[model samples]
Target: MRSVIDIVDLSTEELDDLIKVARDIIANPDKYAHVCDRKKLATLFFEPSTRTRLSFEAAMYELGGHVISVPDAGSSSASKGESVSDTARVVSCYADIIAMRHPKEGAAFVAASKATVPVINAGDGGHCHPTQTLADLLTIELEKNRLGNLTVGFCGDLKFGRTVHSLINALSRYEGNKFVLISPEELKLPSYVKKDAIKSKGIPYEQTTNLEEAMPKLDILYMTRVQRERFFNEEDYLRLKDSYILTPEKLRKAKPDLAILHPLPRVNEISVAVDDDPRACYFKQVENGKYMRMALILKLLKEAGTL
Candidate 1:
């Protein structure tokens, strides 16, 4: 009954093994195409999504598995006030595994606690998004040739960005990895994240309001949207939304091989002109996410003795 509720739930060794599996899937697609034939994946998305939901469905379909999904509460029994645990208990009977995205924190944990099958936390409010971190790790490994000893810069909404929090927590376990956090003062990385992930692990990090000044020193730059949904005040959101737009001119100071990543649905944070630049690997990241999800499905099913 191993479940991935957080990125750190899987150790560095486990992540490396999954990355190896993902690479094998990428290289030998035909051999592993039908590994999960007749298996079913249940996607219980209590929130709106485009990439995460589609990637999970795509992953299952690619592995020859069927998907039964509740894309949102409007179309599910949740509209009748059904509980997450009850939903999990029922869906477990139908699907080999479950991937959930919810608007409330720890909702996936609640589902996994009662489900008969393995559960993956897709995106739980502002809590964590482990699968996205997995995709990020794979992309970094492919582009940089190694995960450790790189200066990674994270820019934009650090406060509400679950992807930022999860990736930092995952990367902190590696050797010689430091972070340069670039964000507006209001959206700086939370103190709890600073204490647990960076400080407790002895991972060095510097905070900055300037993206350009941090560019040349970074081996990787991860950009994020300043989410309008996370803000209580519309005026504050308007003031900060365009704070760190990454443009071609600003990238002139970066290293030639610096990998630029965005857990995207880019709302003008990254310029369209930057897409032509070799450093922008966000689109490649989307494809890598599907392969990583496929690897994860195989791993979890094997652990559950369902495959």
Candidate 2:
């Protein structure tokens, strides 16, 4: 609990404890309101990450702690030739804990290597986004009332959807779970995800390009935008872009109890027609993110012996 660099590092007991604390925070915010009154959280964003940054700030604010942030690398000493490690060392002097998001893969590992204060990785390129994974887990448990034995469908951008990757890896350890990866051929789930997280374990899985065809069978549908910025050519982006959009018409084929999830700031990958469906859980997911962060902040501060 010293640093929340990865969800993979947390055991089942630890994960359960965190979820419990998060629930307690949601039910009784006043009990822990001043726990972090004298603390500070530093946000070091070496890249543009609006949602994650704001979520962390909101969580700390709810705990009555203060926050100091650098919006991006260009606005800070990072633009003046200061190394990330060097910047982290300086910020540690002023903050109780650090949360960083960087464009480079494994950048958080580099920061934690140098930071004296506990460091949480908001994201590190496409390598991982562990805190978001925590949020997703919290949302899933709230929406479904449980975690295991579900058929989860991952649709779109599986090729570069780090959230999808982290979620699959985390959920793979639970019992009676299966996966359906729906994406264009060019955007199929990565080999490591298939081999390391799915295929080798004999976890029942199927892959297809048709979202409509996949809908009928899923307990949870996790949608990700097609990530146009990751495209190399216009033809490729044009070909695969709309292959994943979720609309109400298409969703009619899905089970009534099916819960739809998304790592948002979504574009047209999800149609407005589907927003009114009781199954659409993205907005609720956003609120759940705050509760999860509240739990996380409490755990970290407690572990640091500050709360």
Candidate 3:
């Protein structure tokens, strides 16, 4: 069974195929509605996330499947200290596929390695969030017309943003793709992401602390929340927090077609004033996530021969 642990798990052709499916789902939803009829999707979320959990549940339901949710760890076997592997094996017996979210790094990997059915990593700590990357990719294609040959700026919290790292991994293979990482020194994109994903692939990228300077040059400015908890010192958080906020004044300096996106439940990183702007694509990105995931459910079930 195919399991999504990381973005690198998908080959170039497969990525193209998945994107095509996602686009097709957006174009013709009614045609694919019955594809997952009567199938089961088991969600094992140790850490509660209302958006991701609800998106998965909605995707399955819209595709005519049933859902089984483990919303909290305390109410499940995990509270008594049952291993994740044991839970995976047991859940695999009942569901055709699984999607998991956990607080610990590599928790989804541990479960996927043990499960009989295909397992999708929803989010595992700050390690990786592949599905969000899928949604971002779909958003990129829709907003910018093409994924390749575009300058995409990932602004704010690059170091801890799993969405950033996963997107870089997936996009590195596309021809002429460029990345502009806009973050403070403290939240720079991690070295493994730089060396392993960007530099190794020979994709051009530049890093800077200035978001406004990078604005007009970008086709996609992907915003992420800069959390106070990421800073060890309160003073450091207070200083850098204001640097990343997307004000209307900043948007005025951007390109006319620039797509400002966020994987949101956004904090103060993005100003409320910018929401009225036509270029704010985060909410559209959320709705698109549901359709992308709807596409995903169909693809997974087809591969499993259950569709």
Candidate 4:
């Protein structure tokens, strides 16, 4: 069975297909209501999550499928010291597909190695989050009508933002895509990511400490909160947490149609006042997440011959 452990696991063509399916589901929801009538989705989240877990469950239910979930690590067999592989093998026997999130990097890869069924990595620490990348791709496609030939600015927590890392990898594959990395020096995009995903591809990218200066040039502004959970040092977290706050005044110089996106659970990085602005598409990102997740579940299950 195939498994998705990183954003690179899917080719650009496959991503386009998934996006098309998501848009089709959006336009004709009723037609896809019972596509997974007898299937089952098991959500194994070892880390705390609200959006990814619920979005997966909601997607399955909307497809007329059932859900089995392990909401937390302590409540699962992991509490008894069960390995992720063992958990995946056990869950594979009971569910048609598995969606997993864990705080440990490469944890999903370990689970995918053992699971007999298709495994979808929901999120795995600061390593990668392919599903979030799917949601992002859908949002970008819908918002801009194309993924290429546009400048995308990523602000905040670049070091630990899995969503940022994943999206950067995905977008780098598209033609004429430029990156403007905005973050504090401590939170700059990892050198390996820059070398492998951007520099190696010969894609042009600029690093900046100033968000406003990069605003006018961006077609898309992806804002990320400095993740507290990823930090071992509470002091470091506190210091970088409020690094960049997007307000209406900040958007005055940004393109009128600039799509402002966030993989959220915001702790004041984005002003509530910006929510009413037409440029704010974070909520639309949330809704698109469900649809993209629904599209992903359908594709993986069909590939696994479960549907």
Strongest candidate by lDDT: 1
Cα displacement (Å) at residue 222, model 4: 0.4
| Candidate 1 ranges beyond 4 A from true positions | 71-73, 228-243
Highest-TM-score candidate: 3
- TM-scores, all candidates, are 0.95, 0.95, 0.96, 0.94
Model 4 lDDT tens row, 161-229? 888988999999999999999997778999999999999999999999889899999999999886567
What ranking of all candidate models by lDDT puts the best one first? 1, 4, 3, 2
Q: What is the lDDT of residue 187 in candidate 3?
A: 92
**Model 1: ten consecutive residues of lowest lDDT:** 70-79
lDDT of 2 by residue, 42-161 (tens): 988888877888899999999999999865765779778888788878988999889898888887887888888888888888788887888888888888878889999999989988
lDDT of each: 0.92, 0.86, 0.87, 0.91
User: Worst ten-residue run, lDDT, model 2?
Assistant: 1-10
lDDT-superior candidate, 1 or 4: 1
lDDT of 1 by residue, 1-307 (tens): 8888999889889999999999999999987879999999999889899999999999999998999986475367987888999998999999999999988899999999999999999999888899999999999999998999999999998998889998998889889999999998788999999999999988889999899999999999999987677777889888867668989999999999999999989979999999999999999999999999999999999999999
Please identify model 2 stretches exceeding 4 Å from their true place: 71-73, 229-239
Candidate closer to the true structure by lDDT (higher is better), 3 or 4: 4
Between the candidate structures 1 and 2, which one is better when assessed by lDDT? Answer: 1
Better of 1 and 4 by TM-score: 1
